[model samples]
Target: MKPTGGSVGGFLAAVTPARRQRDAETLTALLQDVSGREPVLWGTIVGFGSCHYRYPTGTEGDMPLLAFAPRKTASTIYLESTAEYADDLARLGPHTTGVGCLYIKDLEQVDLEVLRDILTRSLAWSEAGGSEQAELTVTG
Candidate 1:
């Protein structure tokens, strides 16, 4: 997905050491387990796979889309929205939402089973080219 935010370098500049360390480790393990490929840095706040994207205005683009981030407030997992998973997400754990993303306060507060399920399904949805990045706002 095309990042509508800052450039990769700029984003990286704002990342704290703790956040960067956590994100690096989490993303490394997640990429191996999920996509079986190394995560490519997507602009800034995303570690993604080899997925592609296209906007409704016919602005076609491609990049790794399904990804995650370790924001100051929480760690976010970017998922492709799917109709079938609505109920599952509602019942999964404590979470908030943005335009198209889910916000988990922290991994420790949720069920790993449910989180894994969501991540797995989301990756599938993204691979199928059915999801988009949310216009989310971030705060430290």
Candidate 2:
């Protein structure tokens, strides 16, 4: 499905409980700072910037440079799943991964600095056409 270009404020308000809304807001700000792009509400997810992806099957679509969803269970961070980010993930504190997403129980459970590094590297990777594999360093 195509992105809807919805309002971020509306989306945040729809999220249940004040904590989730606050979390989403915090994530939005961080992603914006890291990506240097405005936030776009793609359905329920807050996405920053834009990128194009083509699967091996030739299926291609446009996605955000960085995106996340404040779900009931955790905050789902959308990022490219590449080996280059292995080190950053190792220092990200408590989190889970799926295909191309990083799931954190909450902001407190993970290292914000590490998360910022991950977001920065992810944005750089996406902006650089995401063709070459490059390693990144994470400092505490």
Q: Among these predicted structures, which one has the highest TM-score?
A: 2
lDDT of 1 by residue, 112-131 (tens): 66766777776666655463
TM-score of model 2 relative to the true fold? 0.85
- TM-score list, all predictions: 0.67, 0.85
Q: Residue-wise lDDT of candidate 2 within 1-140, one digit each (tens)?
A: 34687878888888866777777888988998998788887787888877667655666667777899989888899887835578988988888888788887767677899989988988877766775342222110
State each model's CA lDDT, in order: 0.59, 0.77
Least lDDT summed over 10 consecutive residues: which range in candidate 2? Answer: 131-140
Overall local distance difference test of candidate 1: 0.59
Angstrom error at residue 5, model 2? 2.3
Worst 10 residues of 1 by lDDT: 131-140
Superposed Cα deviation of residue 130, candidate 1 (Å): 2.8
Residue pairs with backbone overlap in model 2:
none
For candidate 1, list the clashing residue pairs, or say none: none
